[model samples]
Target: MSYRLPARPRARFSYTRWQQRFAPYLFVSPFFILFLVFALFPLLFSLYLAFHLWSPLDGLGNWKFVGFENFALALGAQDLFWQTLKNTVWIGLLAGVPQHLVALPLAFVIHQSLRRYQSTLSTILFLPYITNAVAIAIVFATLYSERLGLLNYARGAFGLDPVRWLGDPGMVPYSVAAVVFWRYLGWNVVLYLSGLQAISEDVYEAATVDGAGRWQQFWYITLPLLRPMMFYAFTLTIVGNMQLFEEPFMLLNDGGGSGGAGLTTAMHIFNTAFRDLDLGYASAMSWLLFLAIFALSMVNNLLFSRGGER
Candidate 1:
């Protein structure tokens, strides 16, 4: 009778414990759910559509399996995909190269000279980046007008003939590139400014004590230290420029202005998918563009890595 005395205590549920166990997950669940519904679903569907010939007119189940035919057509010599790709690359180089060249030095100057006004200047520089894309494009379209535009007006004031900034085939790419450059230049400057700020003042002081001149310190110290940020900014520019659409679309219209000179791969893909109603081919071309962007990004990464190692 004495041996059977003690009874075990059962576990009790606590609201606090339950909340602690699942609160973080519950908070994050909305993002994952939305991502699955919106992002992942669309991405997977686009990939599936890439292999099938279907139009919205044909509806969902009427799709016919075409395998890699779409990809083949995009890569073929007769297709406009290659030309659009060339245009895209040319415009990207025009805009992207100068962005870094200007931003790095500009940021360096601001960082060194205008520390007191840094916040105000950063805000001003960032205004364009934050501005609406459509609005920017529209304004730029007005400025790029052949005769009535401010730019041509300036040229005319200088006793120059009003050049067709957006009309000439040779000038269309440069025109589009200029807009892209103006819009993104400030963003790169802000990025470089941030990078410059992260650098230690002690390093500069040490260099100064060791008799290193400003230019020498900048060339040897600042640039090397800023490599990571440069790599980041370059990757963004490459990716953004590769997918460029709205500026060209708005400024040049869907046909990409005279001779299709401003037709970027993105605009081409849009026309293929929407205007031409060849969704399958467009999807395939999209994947191809993705591959191109990825390849360029990898090359940029490799260059940066090599520079770092050296």
Candidate 2:
């Protein structure tokens, strides 16, 4: 005769099918609730503000309706808006493109030739990205000063004249771009290194067996495989470089230096909101800037996307 086990009694809050289906959601509910309260409400309110004229001094009820005046003012009335947009894009491209260019090769070199010192080298390169932008910008500003600056001093040592790094409009972009490049190069390197690690070693071995040289293998196999990583990196760089404000703000004493050559669209927006105290107008400008960012990002996506499945 076989002895049968007794029935397992279910508790009031038993782990039933419904509970199992929603337990994960219940565990994560706090984040979604907070996000709705904080992020979603502010974004919707900002959209509302973009269409109305009002100040914090004026009560929320007193916000006067204004049809596209704010947009027109941002796009047409402000010379600095246009200039800042141009500067932002130029500086972003100069710094951003080279970041990947330098990082890819540097990462490849480290992965291939200097595997022993990879960690040490990566840390050193990545230091600048992790450092405070304000502090680093101040240091870079000191180095860039026209007289008695490290950069100018080095030039003089080589029998060159002291170039106005911050003063001259034409030179300003390059100076800012150089700092941006220096700050972000290592970040790109790290991204590429991680991507390289994700690539299977057997693929490289196969290429080698087929008598593919290093450059050929890299161009044909590695780059194609790294496209996804490249897309991610490119999107980050595009968004980041478009929103450049802090480094230039600190370096130029909060207004992008003389002539506003280094002034980014982000800085212009900040000035519009705080300096001019046109909250409503600034909100509109912000939306427009966001649209521009979306457009560019879409364009980037189009360029980076491959048609066929790999």
Candidate 3:
């Protein structure tokens, strides 16, 4: 004989339908409230400010509506906008590419070969990421100093002359990029490590049984599967490096040292708004940089997606 369970009674205080229907919203109301107060309001305010000529020194009442004159000035004839953009891109590319190159193999080796010391190695790599950029830049500034720096001392020990890492315009980009690379190298390694963890060990064992070597397994199995993570890491590096300011700023000072070779778009924008008090023009340049970043990210997505399909 089969036994039947009794049905439970509904609570008398509960609403028939409406309360149940709005339950999810009740649970998430705090997030919506925060989004409105913090994110949405600031974005809208910035957009409004972008189209108006106003200064921090001037009151809100002083805002004057200027159509696209600011945009025209940023795009049409401002030579510094283009020059700083070129510098930003050059430093970004130089620093960004090697991050992934070094991170992938380093992560894989730690994941597979050095399993016993994995945690310790990851913590060491992650230390640089957690260190303050300004502080690190200050340290690098000392390292780049010509006569008394450790870098120069090491070169002199080898009978080679000290190269001017900071003073010369030609060497400034490399110096800045080097600092950028060092700061983010461990971050990319951590990202790659996460991706590596998601890959199954069983698959590697199966590949090994089929006479696949480490290199072959990496090429055919690991990389193809890690495409999504690789894309994410690459995109982050691009955006962060493109907007680079702090390291260069602290290392080279506001004037970009020597000949402004280390000057980035973000630093230039800051100078325009603060140093020159050109709020309207700076706002326009900011919007223009945002557009460039958005476009480049879109291109990155397309390229990665297409590559994954193949």
Candidate 4:
């Protein structure tokens, strides 16, 4: 009896079964944990900070509950908020309108006329989108030089006077917009190209048999079918243009250069938060800008949904 065999490790499958059930969760847990600590926490903190007055200088827990004061200050007539908004919209339209305008036709051309060279052309076009923003801005800055720049040289060749690209306030926005357009043009082209490729050739063949011309096919078939992709591309453009920074910042420097024509809402927020040490004000401005972006996105959604229904 005393020599009774120790109970065999019979069917102790709990640990193995549990691990099998939860291994995926264990693997994915780190992402959610990191996201909670880094993204969700900071977002909530920023929202809280938006309603209160505090700076890093004031230390943690010293924030004063100022309610809507920060919002009021930003939206007040005296603040630079309105001007920045206007600048942002202007540059956004300048860059965004033409981006789609040019990208659509360019993609159509490549898809229809340059089938054999699609890969090469796409790679060439996509280069700018992948290029470093700072590098692009710096190179563009030199090209925009009023005196000895290539642009001015070209103007001189045309017997026209040199235009101050970054220097003149009137031209600064356009200059910045041009760079933005160039950088994003290829991205949109690629998006449209992918959309075009996904379209069934049978549809186009049927249209062709029905005597549809190139323009008619594009207008009726291509554009209509490409709506989903267009919506996606347009949404990207809207969000990206609203957050315009880096290029303008690098090209014009932190001060936004000459009359602050190139100063976007993002730049203003950065200056307020970091340079001026007004964290709460900047947070409020950010939330306001976010609201504006949301409103615009909703409008776009309504437009697309209505078109889809029609």
Number of the top-ranking candidate, with TM-score as the measure:
4
Residue 84 lDDT, candidate 3, scale 0-100: 91
Pairs that collide in candidate 2 are none
lDDT of each: 0.93, 0.88, 0.88, 0.93
Residue-level error in angstroms, candidate 1, position 176 = 0.8
Q: Tens digits of per-residue lDDT for model 4 on 222-279?
A: 9989988998999999999999988899999877879999999999999999999889
TM-score of each: 0.93, 0.89, 0.88, 0.94
For model 2, what is the error of residue 58's alpha carbon versus the real structure, in angstroms, after optimal superposition?
Answer: 1.6
Number of clashing residue pairs, candidate 2: 0
The C-alpha local distance difference test score for the whole of candidate 2 amounts to 0.88
Model 2: per-residue lDDT, tens digit, 1-65?
99999989876665787688998899899999999999999888878888889887776788988
For every model in order, what is the number of clashing pairs?
0, 0, 0, 0
> Which candidate, 2 or 4, would have the higher TM-score against the true structure?
4
lDDT of 3 at 261: 94
Distance (Å) between predicted and true CA of 252, model 3?
1.2
**Which portions of model 3 show Cα errors greater than 4 Å?**
1-34, 307-310
Q: Which is superior by lDDT, 1 or 3?
A: 1
The C-alpha local distance difference test score for the whole of candidate 4 amounts to: 0.93
> By descending TM-score, how would the candidates be arranged?
4, 1, 2, 3
